[model samples]
Target: MGGTFDPIHNGHLVAASEVADEFSLDEVVFVPTGQPWQKDEVDVSPAEDRYLMTVIATASNPRFHVSRADIDRKGPTYTIDTLRDLREAYGPDTDLYFITGADALEKILSWKDADEIFALAHFVGVTRPGYELSAAHLPADTVSLVQVPAMAISSTDCRARVAQGKPVWYLVPDGVVQYIAKRSLYR
Candidate 1:
């Protein structure tokens, strides 16, 4: 699962858990972006902060792990590079799945090396609130659409809540809440 994971919320965890269970995945590695090219207009939090928050959010799950592949890579973070790196690490024969929200999956064709991405890993598009899960625009063979429980929570909302001095208790993991407060993020 690849995302910016600015604060790594419960919605993310739930989605990963649901996908892992449905697909019988051995592990779910959360890869935080170093610099999100698509989100360049916004002032993203530091990569280290995002990575740490992801670590805190997924630490309890034995099957979940954090990777610094995207954070360690220089320049803009792209899905193709992430898949390629994982392919190299796990070997060419390993079956890798690129899990992402439906909204992001809709924009897959616009991503860098879009066609090649499908060759690297299979894509799993999880349903998100306000986004329809459809593979009409994607290759049917390489993509799978899953309907996860509705989670309206979003990183943007979490950041806004924090900036407005509102509590985000259950929106994200408890450790993430504490880490955000400790780091003074999204202030």
Candidate 2:
């Protein structure tokens, strides 16, 4: 699963879990973007912070792992690049599934190297709250639309909660809650 994963909330974990189970994937790697091209206008927390939080959130899950390929790439993150990197690392024999939110999947065609993306890996578009999932625009053989456990939780909301000095205990993991408090992120 690839995302900015600004704080690595429950929704992310749930989506990854669902996709892994549905696809019978050996492992689900969470790739946090180094510089989220789409959200460049807004302030994103440090890449290290986001990476560590992702690690913390997925630490206990044996099937879940965090990858720093995007964070360490040192450039604007594009989905194609991510897929390519993982493909190269895992080799040609392995099947790679690019898991993303339904909203992002809607814009897949607009992304650079759209054709190459589909050729590289299968895409899984997981539904999130308020996002209408439609595979009409995607290739039937390349994309799969799935409804994960409905989670209204968003990283943006979690950041806002911290900024407002509000509690975000259950919305995020225990370690994340503590990390946010210790680092005074979004304050």
The sequence of per-residue lDDT tens digits that candidate 2 reaches over residues 3-97 is 88888899999999999999999999999998888888999999999999999999999989888889989789988888889988888899999
lDDT of each: 0.92, 0.92
Model 2, TM vs. native = 0.98
lDDT of model number 2: 0.92
Residue 18 miss distance in model 2 (angstroms):
0.6
Lowest summed-lDDT stretch of 10 residues in model 2? 129-138
Local error of candidate 1 at residue 43 (angstroms): 0.6
| lDDT score of residue 103 within candidate 1 | 90
lDDT of 1 at 42: 93
